[model samples]
Every structure is written in structure tokens, then in C-alpha cells.
Target chain A: MIQDIMTVAETAKLIEAGNVLLLAGDEAVLRQLPKGNWIGGTIPYFISHAEGGLATRDRIFVTDVTGVAQSVEIVERDANGLAKVYAEGPQEGFSVVIIPALSKAHLSFALNAPNYKDFGVRPLIGWISGVHLDDLGKVTPKVFNGVTGNALEEGAVVLQATLKPGKVAEVGIVNLFEQGGGDILTFPADGFSAKEVLVNGEKRNFAAYIVKNKLDTRLPLVADYYGALVNISFQGIDEVEGEVKFYAPVFTGIRYKHAKPVADYGEAFKACLENKCQLSEDRVVFSCNCILNYLYSGLEGKKTDPFVGPITFGEIAYQLLNQTLVYLEVHDV
Target chain B: MDVPSMSRPQWTDLVTGKKTYQLKFLAAKILLGRLVHSVKENPTPANIKSCIEQVYNVYAKNAGSPSVQEDLTTIFG
Candidate 1:
């Protein structure tokens, strides 16, 4: 029934099937509207039922965000030739985008071209959040879309689309060739890292060096599990006790910290406390796995550098963060 | 409410309007990318340098991230 909604269109096959079209809006609007065959496939109706009925009662509402009337439509044809317009709209806000078929196969492409990743992937969820319904009165497969916001501009490339765990799948910015596919970029991290770690005979406090230079705002680690908590927790995994190689942050020599020899994690902590260790803007980065290995095994046997030995997810995170102020300047995106 | 005076701003700061929150998110992800790439790739001084800079630049694009207001408050406060 044509109600308070700004616009709506029903399927044409139903009308072509010769079913008498009778519709009512809410309980008290009191007028059963006329139903007719599709024009170019769209069942176009004006917004009168919404004039006084529940429409004015604030049932279904659609607000314009870009400060313009957004177009809504029910397209019957997938391609251009059959391009049947089942419905069209400037639908009222707070309304349900009701669909005819509630199936996993139900599909609709957005014309807005939104990018959620740009808004931190949080605000973008609004585009994909809605109830999908079908003629059989059953809920279809829920789809969840993880779109990289940058590619979701007015006419950018669509990146990803898919179904989610629940019956509420959503897809956003179907394109993203410009953002990642173009240039280099940078950002910040909470920097979950240990400031100081004690190997066998040496102790280095990367944290104090960072704090000394007022760069510790993002650093978040005290005595981490690597150099200090190793002896007690891990025992057999002592593969990284020899020739440890640290991947220090070059920082263009901005903040530099001196690497030293200490007794253990305790000594590293004590040295930091006693010296009021200052964060060095010039810094280097190393893996805690190596320190953890040394802490557990000590210098009993020859050790090798894992930085050159193996790779893990954590190592990747560290390297990328080290050069966060980077760029590859591809202007095309 | 009267509309605020600062309606329009430049693009540089506008892109990173939420720099603080965005950086952290990108930082973690960059690190992941680095780890994955380092497998067959040998990380040396020149190599590490470019990798560091590349990852940094890539992640910096996520302008509006969590805790960014706090970071900006610290930087400009």
C-alpha cells in the first residue's frame, strides 16, 4: 500500500498475473488505494497516504543527509535493455526498505557509492544495515560487507561485497582501485611494544629512550613477556639466544637510544627507573621472540638471529609501523 | 544552534582530521603487511628503509581512527 513513504514500486509480474490490487495505509488512514499495471515496469504512486495517516504519525521516515532528495528505486531489470523500473523514490525517513524476495540470491547495487573504511569502517555500517525481506515471508541470507572506504567516492571502484554470519549481509563501496592501488601512505599505532628488554648479559630500554623524547604517547609496554617474563613462563622455545639483530627505527636519526648490557628484565626495569630513562627519538626495533628465547635458554649454547631466520605476523606489524610516515604518491586514486 | 564559523578547511588537515585515531589502526596493519612480505624478501639497510617508509605512507591514509582526538589534543594541546 502507498503510505507515508516518499515513493515505492511493487513487482509487475504480480499485476501481470491479474491479482486485484487493493492496499490500505496503516489502521485509520481509511482509504483503500487503487492498484494498476506497471509503466515501464515501475508502479509509480504519489505521497498522499502519508499526508495524514501514520505517515504524519512518523512511521516511515527518510532524511536527506547531503541536503538533497536521495533517489530510491526498485529495479526489475538487471541490464539496460529490460531496464524495468519497478519503483522509484524520495522515500520518507525512518522507513523499511522492504524487498519482494527474501532469498540468499537477492541483490541490489547502491548508487551512492559509500566508503566505510574512510570513516574508520564504523559509520559506513549504516549503508549495509537493514532488513531484507521476500515474498515468502522468510528472512534471506545475511550479508556483511567489508569495504575499504577510500574507493567509495562518487564514482570510484567498488572493493568488496559478501554475505555475513547472520541474515544481515551488507556491502559498501564496491570499488577501491584509487586508494591502495595508487600510492604510499602513513598513520599511527598504539605501539604495543616493550620499552626495555634484558637478554643474557645486556639490557636495553627502548621505552625509556622513546619517553625521553616525548614520543611515548603511543608507546604502551612496561616489562613485557619477552626479556623479563621468559624464564618463568617459557622454557623449551629458546631458539633465539645468539647474535640478536634488532630492526631499529631509523627515524632519520631523529631519536636515538643506546643499546647496553644488563643482567635481566629486572635490571632493565631498574636501570630505566634509576636513570629516569628518556625516550630516544632515534630508535631501533627488534622482536621480543628473540629476547624471550634468550631469557628462557640463556647463553648456554650458540644462538641465531630470528630476524634473519623466520617471519611471523607480529614482525610484519612492527616493520610497517616503523616507517608509518611513508608515501608513494600515486595521484591517480 | 548558530552554525560554527569553521565550516570549510584545507585538504591536508582535512584528510587527517582524525589523525591520532587513524594512525594507530594503520600502524598495526602495516606491521602485519611487513611481516608477510619479509619472507622471501631480504631486509637490509636500504631495503628496510624503503619498506619502513612505504608501510608508513600506506597506513597514514586512514585519517579518522580511534583515539585520534586524544592524540591531536596531545599534539596541539
Candidate 2:
């Protein structure tokens, strides 16, 4: 797996050599690459081999999938067309997707992907493309269909790759936060922003509740989807409007609790990865950790060894996830 | 923990929240999650049957796993 940052010329050389690549970099640098078998999204931040967490616009982070993929196909889909994503994917392989942040496709996928046809039936992993923090309002995040060299700001760019026979792809997530011993919270509806919540079956103003309890907004609300511990990170609390915004949607019937506080984010990640993931580094072909984790955990100079890729705005294991590390492993049957 | 053997009625009961059991596979979890939501909204026999058929088809596709195949037989038989 060639997961490393390279100069524009180096990346173009790989693309020109027929490498099937997943790329992340600045829009300008990604635009400079030669059209080939690749899919890219704009993000200047990455966790590179040489640097623990680096932000650079001049280089591109590349994951060469040519070694494991027998054949690769790239497709672009808008919000309404994303329902066929899983059904259209290869039966024996996995799909990697990149949707620009704040795009209609991103919001649609985040809220409705679980209801999509054949959801979670196959391995699907990817991240949400984003601009640098400084460029949040000034620029839009974009995805590239490398074959056409078209940069799209509205839809998703998907790379569906069929694995070689005997090689199977599996998706897994590592989340450091778990349900804390607090009031069980449920929302009035499914949405990214909530003005009302049920606290222990009692109605309460969502933002007011957080403010009254002096809750730490950095810690997300955690829900157990079956056995998987999923997170909904807090984006912000609107005091005057009495609304609480989240990075991911909170469903109506789901039970969620504030995450247990972590004394040390870096050590917590290291220990969680050590205990939960005994992954052989080589088997992990692709992976991405959330940018919130990178920022909150102070990972700028720290290494989360054995896992490296773009530090993204959001993550996808099968559905949109927040504050989680999603990885795809190729195993021999 | 042993895999709980469930009959079709028991499966419906579980989906309708009459009983609860920890699902052992991702396929079961994903299918049951949607079914549970569906039956909660409308507990009609046709709706429940449609959910069951969907589950059977998805489980059949993943019958490559011995455990899934075993569960399928245990539930449908």
C-alpha cells in the first residue's frame, strides 16, 4: 500500500503509470495530476508516514489500490442517485466514496444512507472532503472523477474496486468514546440539529439542557447501533436559538448518552487501537481518521502508528460516522 | 454465548419488540434494524412478511458464512 504524501509530479507519474489511486490534497495540486485511474477529494490535511499530522497544500496524499484491485470503476452520483450505490457495487469487493463537505450529497447520505437499498450489505468505506479550516467559508470542497478530470462540488465520486479472487475486503471502525453513565437522551426527530430532546423520557430543551449541565461539548453523544458504537459529534450549541447542532444526525428512536470523558486523547487512541485492533499493518489497504480527532487529540506531532491516511472532515464505515477511524482490510480467504 | 434458535413467529415477535436477543452478525443487525423500525410503524401481516422475505434474501446472499446459514435454517425451518 503506497500511503504517502508525494509531490504533484510524483503523483502524476503514478497516475500515468496506470495506478488505481485514492488521493487527497489541495484542489490546485490535485488538479495538476494527469487524468487516469484515480479518484480524489480536496483536503490539505493528512496523517503522513514522515509526519504524524501534517497540513500542506503543495503535496498529495495517495493510496495506491492497484495491487489489490483486479479492476476499478469510478462513478459520480448526485444526492438522488446515491440510492443505487450499494446495489451497483461489486459483489465481491468494496467501494470508496468521497463527497464534498456541506454538499447536498453529504447531507443526504448522512441522514438517509441507512435506509438506502442494500445498505451495509457490502464493504463501503471513505471520507468527507473538506477545505482547510482557514478556507471554510471562502472555498468549497470538491471531488474529482480522475477519468474525466471534472471537479464536482455537488455530488459524490465513488471508486468501486473488485478485489482479486481469494482476497476479501472488510470494513472496521475504531471509536474511543463510549456511552457515559448519564441521562439517556433521545431526539424528537432525526436531524443534524435538534431544538428538543427527551432526557430520561422527559422533554427538555436540547441546548438549554447542555448549558444547564455544563456538559463538555467536545465529547460527543454516543449510540450503540447494534454492537457498533457510533458517535455524533457536537458541532455547536446555539444558545439564543435553543438548538444543538451535531456533526451527524441523531435518530428519533435511538438511545444516546454523552461520551465518557477521556483524560488523554492521545493515550486513549493508542490504547484503544492496541486493544481493539490487532491489525497487521500490511493488511490495511485504506484508512481515514476524523479531523475532529486530529484536532481534539492534538495529533499534530503525535503518531497513531499502524494507521495512516487522510485526516478527514467525516468518516464512513458503511454510513456517515463522526470521530471514528474507518479502515478497509483485504484478507485472503 | 450460544446462537439463539428462533422460529418464524419468534422472529416476528422479536422484530415487533415482544422479545429481544443480541444479533450475532452484521447482516442480521442491519436487516433487523430496518425491520424493527418498519414493524413499529405498521404491524400488518403483509409488512412483517415483506420484512422477513427481505431478511431471507439478504441472509441467503451471505450464506457463505456457516453461522448465517445455520441461523437461516433455524429461523425459517
Candidate 3:
């Protein structure tokens, strides 16, 4: 039996091999509503009789509901008039998973993702996004790339894109409840032992799929974990003077799931604020700093909140909104 | 370390900076582990294998401790 999850290197290989791909959707048009993707079809939509905080069984009545506005009409039609049932949105709305304003290369990559066309070359990276329910459900964080020709701070602009099929999912692709949302890219780790290692559930290969043909355009998105977080930070920059640093409440990735699902950024933010997140005290680590710094070197402004050696109150509050930082450990700066 | 030969520049890179890619990578891995372990009850065999592979590949390449080294080999080797 298989026990441990694949390491990043191994995960990289699997991703390369195309055994799995980040789940994704075909293209569809939008109608200007804040939309949410729904599971393909298993879960049925019903009217939420009461209003307030969302209950387990409540359905956001399409328009007035608190969830992302995913019209069941979010789908594609065959020449025969049969709808594909994947979550789709009107032209004006957007999704964090497949946003175009950030990176066209990212979106294009997503379009042909897992394009197992060339089986003999390198396995293609596949993406699967079943993230239908937004954690905040209402307020979707806008994806901001650094505005060009402006200082990093000045051009910290939230962006929007011209989207296509890959940008939208058919209304009823998969059941979010049965699917249990959140993107995961599984990799190798030392979480397994000799005896019962093969069945280590936690070690399974779960990864986020952010590579939706993501680079065809000039968007600044990247294919790493800190996805939008890093993009926002590196929004505007033009070299360096002092130093760039971001101090925020960072949670241990070890217990991040316990806090909140990535699909729901608000509750995760809530969990971090409630002190439910923790700082990781152990384990070997790696920083995709190369990836991050690469972005910073190209940005127009310094997005660092304050490098006063420790996190500032404002920084903490900002992190509270993004929920990216979990622990408040201040590095000796 | 299990691997082999390193120059002086390697040592400087490892300890000279407060936020070297090396340190951050380790920090990220640890963070990922802590976060994942806390919730992975029976992280699937595939998940376990993936985790083990990540741990060992990094260890083999980076060369950390004896216990972790031993554990990694048992799973991947």
C-alpha cells in the first residue's frame, strides 16, 4: 500500500507525469453577477428559508444569497442544447482560481492543462478546481497586480480580465459537499512509518491548481502556494532601496486545514484571529523565496507593510483580512 | 551529511542571511507539515507517500538529521 504523500520533488514529478491535474472547467460567458462555482451535479440547490449566518443546509437563493453568484445557468450548451452543468459566471464577475487580470499565461495553461496530448514528452500539469463555496462567501478578495509605470505602492491596483471558457466552470460540475472543496497538490513528506505507512491518509497528494494556462498575458500571478498573496505584495516595485518585508500573523501550514478551508478565506481569517492558528515549531522547511523574490525584483512598488523588525498593528489587521499569516513570531530585524 | 562535497560558499549561503531561501524553504516545509499533520487523520496512502517523498527528497538533497534520514529511506528506498 502507499503510505506517505509524495515530496515536492516527487509531487513535481507526478505533476509533470500528469497522473493528476488541478480540476478545471470549460469556458462560458458571464452576466455581471458575483458568481460562485457549484459542485457539478450531486448536490441539489434549494432555497434557504431563513437568513443570517449560513447554516449547513441553507442555499443562497442564487442572487440575494450570501454565496458567490453562480447562476445554475452557469454552463455551456452543446449544439443539441444540452448544458454541461459546470459552474459558470456572467461576463462581468470573476473567480480567484481562474482570474485573467492576474495572468493570461496562467489561464491559458489552465485551458490546455492536463492536455495529455504529448504523452511521450513530459507529463502535463493538470488542474482541478472544485472550489464552489467561498469562505467569506460574499466578499471575494480582488486580485491585484502591480500597475505598470507606477511606484510599487502607488500602482497597487486590483485587476480585472477578459475571460473565456476556462475562466468559468459549468454550474453543476461536481458536488462541493461530497467533493469537500479546497485545492491541494500532494507531495512527499516523512509522515509515514514502516508498519502502517501505506494507508496514511494525510499523506495523500492534495495540491492547489493555480496554473490555468496562467501566463499567456501580462498578468503577474505565479504558480506557487502564496498565490494572490505574493502577487499583491509584489504589485509595484522598481529595484530596491532599504528592504522589502511583510510582517503578518502566519499560521503553521501544519494545522491550516483545522482553521478553515482555503475556499473560504473569511472563516480562515476568523480562525486565525481567534488564535486558532499556531506557529510551527518543528519540521524541515523550504521557502519558495526564489519564486517570491523573482516576483519582487520585477514589481513596481514595495508592498511591505512595515519592516520595523516586528509586525505592526496594521500589518496584523491586514493579515487578518487575508488570513495568510498565522503566527505572530517577529524575526529579529 | 549523506550526499557529498560542498564548497565554502555553500556554508556562507546557509548561515549568513536572516531570510535566505534555504531557511525559508525549511520554514515552509515545517509549516506545511504542522498544518497538514494536524488535520490528516489517515492522510491517504497517496498523501502519505507524497509527504514521505517530499521529506526524503529534501533530506537527501539537503541532508538534515539521522532519524528523519532513516525514516525517509524506509519509505522511499
Using Cα atoms, each model's DockQ against the true complex is 0.06, 0.29, 0.04
Scanning candidate 1 chain A in windows of ten residues, the lowest lDDT window is: A169-178
**Can you write out model 3's per-residue Cα lDDT over A50-131, one digit (the tens) per residue?**
3211112111112111122222222222212111111221242222111211123222322222121211011001111111
- In the range A1-333, model 1's lDDT, one tens digit per residue, is 111233223322333343222221121121111233111101111122123111121122221111111221212222121111111111121111111111211112221011101211211111111121121133221211111111111111111111111211111110000111111111121112233334222454433433343432211111111111101111111123322122222211011222222334334433543463222211111111122222222422222211111111011111211101111100111
Model 2 over residues A48-145: C-alpha lDDT tens digits?
76888989999999999999999999999999998888788888788999999999999999999888887766678899999999998999999999
Which candidate ranks first by DockQ, i.e. highest? 2
Q: lDDT of candidate 2?
A: 0.85
TM-scores of chain A across the candidates, in order, are 0.15, 0.99, 0.18
Residue A94 of model 3 has an lDDT of 24
Structural similarity to truth (TM-score) of each candidate = 0.19, 0.91, 0.19
Docking level for model 3:
incorrect
Candidate 2: segments with Cα more than 4 A from true spot: B1-34, B37-47, B54-59, B62-77
Lowest lDDT sum, 10 consecutive residues, model 2 chain A, at A115-124
Instruction: Output the worst ten-in-a-row residue range by lDDT, candidate 1 chain B.
Output: B2-11
What would the TM-score be for candidate 1 when compared with the true structure?
Answer: 0.19
